[model samples]
Target: MTWSIVARDPETGAIGIAVASRFFAVGARVPFIAPGTGAVATQALINPLYGPRGLALLRGGAGAAEVVHALVADDSGRDHRQVQVMDARGRFAAHTGTDCVDWCGAIADDLCGLAGNMLAGPQVLEETARAFRENAALPFPRRLLVAMAAGEAAGGDKRGKQSAGLVIHGTEDWPDLDIRVDDHPEPIAELARLERVSRERWVHFKRYLATGADPVGITDRARIDSEIAAAVAAAQAQDAGEPAAGKAPAA
Candidate 1:
């Protein structure tokens, strides 16, 4: 019923998950990530517990393989669950339950794991992983979107698309970006639009928020507002292929 990619950005140590499913609100249950720990996607029959428990194990120094092994070890329904994990160290592991619907399986490689159940075919996961690997130059979040989009193009969830989501975490425990199209005819496109919307303001605004290193973030409202305005205008200018004011190239 779903397919997903769990990955860690080797350059920034950011970890995240991107997922889509025929099911409603797949975002609410499928993808889970801890900032400095790892990421998990649990689908197929969908064991919600695997998300938090897997992250906890990752945080406790369990490798991706150990985490998956532990999670499935005691579950009587393991044969019906599909889960994948990528640890902070770029280790990867996955499980595609034997009882999952046909066209189900998983692939794990350093820094990435891809898994799906009830998919159109093996190409879905294959293209997803391939895209992620080939687009290493893209920003982590955008790379995820591109990869998922490739999977969709290769034939996504066999039943059709409904919900899609992307989640990313930076140095902070909180997510740098978490957007979902809980139910949409074109959930991936909707998710992409939301990503653009986020770039319009939220992305720059987040810089002023409190962080672990600086509990009390920027307090000067006027300065913060000015910075945000400048950031937005600069982004707009870049989108238009023009240099921002005071940033023009020298003749």
Candidate 2:
């Protein structure tokens, strides 16, 4: 029903997932990630339960393998299930239920996971892992999209592609990225284009909100620095000379 990869870059603390399927809007159902938390990919007969449960386990300090074991143990339908998990610590794990459709399997690598069902062969997952591991020049989302494209080229979802998705949830100061190509003729390619445009739009919005201070019109750094210095001076002025370290100031 679905195939995906969940991964985190140890150097950047950036978590990402890439997946594709014959199903419509694969993005809407398979991948889940929280900036500082972790990532999960739930597919193969598609159990939505694993999304929140996996996240909860990771947030509670469970490692990737531990969470996968717990989830599989708890599910009576383990053989029909496929899932991949990577924690914030970059630990990785994956599962391919025995009952998954033909040509289905997964590959869990150092910092990434790849899975697929109804693929041309095991090469789908292999290509995904190879593309991700070998590409050092691309951003996280683009890397993900490239890996997915590689998977598709390697005979993805044997039934052919119908939908694709990319999701990234980060800090409040950073906008979250979520894109979907549902029922598109060439989903992965379209998804990549959408990602590029969306990223540009985000940059545009950020630029438009600039405070007219820096060369790029960002926040007024000089003014802010001056204000903070003034506040510090005022606090120092309220203090008596040579106050004891660690002692409260006299009222």
lDDT of 2 by residue, 1-251 (tens): 66787776555666777677899878888987856878888888778999999999999999988989988999999999888888877777888899999898777757587878878898888877777776655557777777777777778888877998887755432335677888988888888778757643452344334342543444666665565566555545653442222111221
Using lDDT, give the best candidate's number: 1
* lDDT measured at residue 109 in model 2 versus the true structure, 0 to 100: 59
lDDT, candidate 1, 1-251, per-residue tens: 99999888888888889999899999888988988888889999988899899989998999988999999998999999999888878888889889999799998777578999999999999888888887786668777887888888889999999999999999997789999999999998788778878888899988989999999889898998899999999877665742211111221
Residue pairs that clash (backbone atoms under 3 angstroms), model 2: none
Off by over 4 Å in 2: 172-175, 203-251
**C-alpha RMSD of each candidate structure in angstroms:** 5.7, 15.6
Per-model lDDT:
0.86, 0.74
Candidate 2 has an lDDT of: 0.74
Clashing pairs in 1: none
lDDT of 1: 0.86
Weakest lDDT window of 10 consecutive positions for candidate 2: 242-251
Q: What TM-score number comes out for model 1? A: 0.92
